[model samples]
Target: MSVDINNYNPTRVLVGVPYVNTVFHFIVGGGGTTLNLTDQISNDNSIGFGKGVAWIASDQAAILANIYTSTFSSWLSSQIWVYTQLPSTSLASTPTAIIPNSQQPIPSSISSELINIVSTPSGLVVLDVSGGILFI
Candidate 1:
């Protein structure tokens, strides 16, 4: 249903069968800066992937503010930029998740990168726009 990563290791390789209709939320710790969603392969040592959301430092606040104001258009626009501008070096592939049209709240003590995914009748909806600095 929900998973919380406290000390997410950037070096650790995450390998799994592609999921469908699943939502991933990478919550940031109080002292955390930003979450890097790079894919790592143990054998190849090639640090590159193309599927996940990496929230930058200020993105948490920016997204929250826009959502609070009920500005879905602006929020989606900004997200499009943020998702696409991610760097390609040693970075994971673009996320196959969807950004909810509404705001989903988490504890104030913690920040998070929410990723909603749905793949049943349709294909994966990976958000690949252009903007925001990818936290590598």
Candidate 2:
């Protein structure tokens, strides 16, 4: 469940698989432009994303999905960030999503971002913290 984007191409976006811990950098246009897949950082083991995908909603709107927490101590939740304007470049962008934790038989104990994401013809799907899948 991944979007296969490579290198620093501005026309495409890459959302890595669960535990892959990667997302593309973006340079947003006034009218929402195609999201880009720029540099990916793998060496930084301290931080990582579980899973997610990206898509252009319109000329001025795009959906970027990922696992995020407000702080290291905050619970990592699966969510999407609606970018009215995308960041020029930054890994610490915001994320907002609907979590599937309540559906899990056993809740996740780890207090870090641990969701996986994929795209489908229907829309975006997420593998949530407690190991359940939810369609967005």
Candidate 3:
């Protein structure tokens, strides 16, 4: 008996590839220079303002951590993210931090960072505070 290889189709498998908008299976978080305005990998010692975090990068319109000491956009000033997939879900925005404020460290894990991702538009406000997303 011969089988049609092209007929092989799996929703979970196909939709979960390294394509655009494909959700990262793991969580995203980590502590690596918060007050940094540049995404340069060399300048990683300045991880102070919102420092000490780790995560496995997951699929979300915006990563919203709970590290808000003030208005949630003060401290660090800015942040950088290395996206696992291209053409990210963020339609209008570019790669950005999971949390809203570039100021404080996320109080919770990246998963609970946002109040509601199911209803969120794009441009995830994530919190990089886990090791899984970093490893996988």
Q: Against the hidden reference, what TM-scores do the models get? A: 0.17, 0.37, 0.18
Write model 1 residue lDDT over 90-124, tens digit each, in one string.
32233322233355323333223323322222222
Model 2 C-alpha lDDT per residue in residues 39-125, reported as the tens digit of each score: 453322333342444553321122223433434454434434433344434432443323333443224443224455454546555
When sorted by TM-score, best at the front, the candidate numbers are 2, 3, 1
Pick out the ten consecutive residues of candidate 3 with the lowest summed lDDT: 1-10
What is the lDDT for 17 in model 2? 40
**What local distance difference test score does each model get?**
0.26, 0.41, 0.25
Flag regions of model 2 displaced more than 4 Å.
Answer: 1-11, 15-22, 26-51, 56-76, 84-114
The per-prediction tally of clashing pairs is 12, 8, 43
lDDT of 3 by residue, 45-86 (tens): 222221221222332222212233344453333232323332
Each model's Cα RMSD: 16.8, 9.0, 16.4
Question: Which sections of candidate 3 miss by over 4 Å?
Answer: 1-61, 66-95, 102-114, 119-136
